[model samples]
Target: MTSTAEEEVLIGFGTTCYYLVFRLMITTTGYGLAALGSLIVIRTINLDNAKSWREPKSIQLLCSLIILSCFTGYIILQAAHAFIAIKAGIGGNPVSLAMLLTDDIQLFLNATIILVGDFVICWRAWVLLSEDKFWRYFLALAMIINIGINIADPVYDVPNMKSELKGVFNVLDWLSVACSSIVNLIATSLIAWKAWSHYRLSRETSIWRVGRQSHRARWVLLLIIESGALFLVLQLFALATETGSSFSGSTFDKDLTFVTVAKVAGSLWNVSAALYPLAIIILVHTNNSPIEETYYAGTQHTPVSLTLLGNMRHSASGGGESTAF
Candidate 1:
């Protein structure tokens, strides 16, 4: 009901963007729910397999299920954010919408979960790599930083805090993004390189070939992780442009463009994570019949005659070799 053309135009644009965002959010939420279903199916299969084999553990399958659970929660949170974004179309004010965006406990919880997941990935990578103590310490530091950010977010998010601390927290948040990304990029690259090295070292050995397969699988995982990292950079850039331009009194067109770009980038970032499982599926093959084969090769461990000798020793010792299990 505004009389001004500028007000009408801005409202129109905001409504359009909000609609687009809402659509994407719904799509993302559906995909996440589907992922959760898929994980449930996978978990059932793993549980059945373990039951049949009488095996007590399936670590890989367990990890996948956990990731799926987190992703499911993420999708729900995204849907909530989408609702907030769309609230603007129904005569919601910008500042009110901003407040709504920050008001959700779910948003903060989701962000924290994501941050913790990244830390877990980094720490696990270091443990697998047998990396120096410094890597673990660095991971700890990153986790602490992330926790600090989460704690400070509420305090700094008071009314008009956007005008007060936008620059400071935006920079800090972006820095956190950068730090996590660099850690993953470096760790995954190193893992890929090491895996490739093993592949090159032994070409003809079938059993040792599993090690190479593991390497390939790991390489694929690394690529997915790195793609997510690159997307984070895009997100940070978009955030900077969108929020930064607002404070600078940029043109309406520029503001619209920046916000649209940021929305697209954020959608891509979410979709990228969802697609990681497809990457693993592509990397797997008939040659890599056993799930462990690729991981074995990637681990720099070469199966040898010593395995046979150890088996014989287990039989000779008559204790069923507790180490093997």
Candidate 2:
């Protein structure tokens, strides 16, 4: 790496207060969200612990435990790494394994979080888009590609991460984020299409006539928002950070700013990825599809594909209602 980059990473915490503050802020947000996620997981498990292993709720419970376990460890390690670096002062290089073992374990936790998070997203999309077999197949294929990228990127980046390690993984980091964006884009689009089709069907069927004009519009938008919209935005920020940091084979900022941006971006992606499922689980366990229950509460007609909130309890006989999730 360049002398400036080396100095930035090797400097004491006192010298890079901006980096420390930004890094701390990122971690704090992640820390708080992680804590909340942990509570949600606990509440979920406590409520549904009596559920049979054959129950579908068991699948969600299992996923929540696995994700929250990894997420808590990852955030705690990040917090510890920061403090350790601060204590180590000029000897610190938290970004590198040479500084501590945090980097090594972090890589494992990160890969697991991203891998599982992506799977959950794809699985949600697959379940939500039940009627469309073509898109389901397409989504599965995209997920397969997503799985391969998440696995291979870390394996390839690790050797390079240790040697000649820098603030960002440069090209590899951006590539991974880009792949994530593409996969999520596909998933989100499928959900939006399904939402729109169902909303139009509701309108034509006059179920939407029971309310104000914006009711139909609001319903469709809510479905889109619930289905990975925020997560997609976070992925874009992560992608921008990765590409912005060093697109031309050089750090964008010569000072501690580059490290701050990279560290914040890394933390941002980690917490956001984990929180996606946490949010869904929280919504499901607590309110159990408020949108579905609220809008379709009194109406005799419920949208065929109203699984955005995962409200598909059982497969009823219909041409449109398919619980592939």
Model 2 pairs whose backbones collide: none
lDDT of 1 by residue, 18-103 (tens): 75666466557646654754455463433442443322124434444555666666566556655655565456554454545544
Cand. 2 Cα-lDDT: 0.63
What's the distance in Å from true for residue 249, model 1?
A: 4.0
By TM-score, the best candidate is 2
Estimated TM-score for each candidate:
0.59, 0.73
Clashes of each: 5, 0
- Per-residue lDDT, model 1, residue 292, is 24
Count of clashes in candidate 2 = 0
- Per-residue CA lDDT of model 2 for 1-325, tens digit only, reads 5598766555544555556566667766776776777676666554333435544445666777787788778767867776666666645443544444776677778878777777766766665665679988988887788778777777776676456544544565677778878888898777666556655554454444345465646654546455778789878877876777664456474445765666677667777887776666555555443233222211223432454223223222223443322
